[model samples]
Target: MAVKLNTPIKLVLFDVDGVMTDGTIYMAESGEFCKAFNVKDGLAIELLRAHEIKSGVISGKASPALTNRCQKLGFDIIETGCKHKLPKLEQICTNFNVTADAIAFCGDDVLDLPIMERCGLSVAPADAHQLVLEQADWVSAYKGGSGMVRDFVDTLLLSQSNIGLKEIYQPLLRKIALDDLTGVEQ
Candidate 1:
């Protein structure tokens, strides 16, 4: 049997360390925290926004760098240092007034299981742990922080032909009627 994303997701949730940052942490001599992020994933977030999909970041550990990155990305929800994610998931659901079935979550480890189990669509990176890969409804071909989110975003957007992504672009195109088109051609 094959598993697929049956319903279109309105919200996208991601884990920070593995899904967005390649699961690596670098501590400088001065104790500054840093993580490497893939540019492709950042573009994926832009694509999601183009299609009017809400997005957020949920991480077990907190980092100022991660917070700034998410803010710059325009993610709607930012939950950091959350060891217990289920409650946070509930809070998101409530805030968005969206059902669990309209959410997609991509995770790479054990801590992500509970919410993944409850979400309508669950994804894991190719390099995720054995247990997480086994439980995932969809395992991405790309590894974490290496275009995994891009792969998922592409798949999700491709699956929505009827929704017409062109329509999403039209509004911005109109604004560019020789005016607010500062970044329209992009």
Candidate 2:
């Protein structure tokens, strides 16, 4: 599909399971569910904040790992255990004082169609469900749980300005380096 980012996207919302993780749930021996998040995606969230773009996540099922990731990333909105997301999207629009057209959404399953259809720009990872891929305005070259989020953010930033990808990743590289050198999470 042809790629076109919606301009002036004030809010960007993501679906958790398939869009963030690889739609896999690993249950530890303690019965706690674990999910692996990509560091590049974390950097993408930071980049969004740096650019003054609001970011959020909506998930049907809630997990402590997901909550920690969202909190650490400073997401503007985080809705979990939400079976129906359309109403949440409406509430988000009201809370942010922006219309649906100003929102960009990334989702990877059939359940996400309602919000996807309503959002200004709909995105999906390359490994997304067939139905989702068919409808998404932009499909990332990378799969979820890889670099899809970074790809989306890179495209969004590029569409909004002349900033190069290298420029966008420079700050993240410094942070990662500092964290590695100090043995402390950044």
Candidate with top TM-score is: 2
Model 2 segments more than 4 A misplaced: 169-185
Displacement of the residue 144 alpha carbon in candidate 2, Å = 0.9
- lDDT (10s digit) by residue, model 2, range 11-123: 89999887778888999899888888888888788888777789999988898888988998889999999989999999999989988988889999988999999999999
The TM-scores of all predictions, comma-separated, are 0.87, 0.88
Q: Ten residues in a row with the worst lDDT in model 2? A: 1-10
Regions more than 4 Å wrong, model 1:
1-3, 162-180, 183-186
Kindly give the stretch of ten consecutive residues in candidate 1 with the minimal lDDT sum: 177-186
Error of 1 at 51 (Å): 0.4
Task: Report RMSD (Å) for each prediction in the order shown.
Answer: 3.3, 2.9
Task: Rate residue 22 of model 2 by lDDT.
Answer: 81
Alpha carbon lDDT of each predicted model: 0.85, 0.87
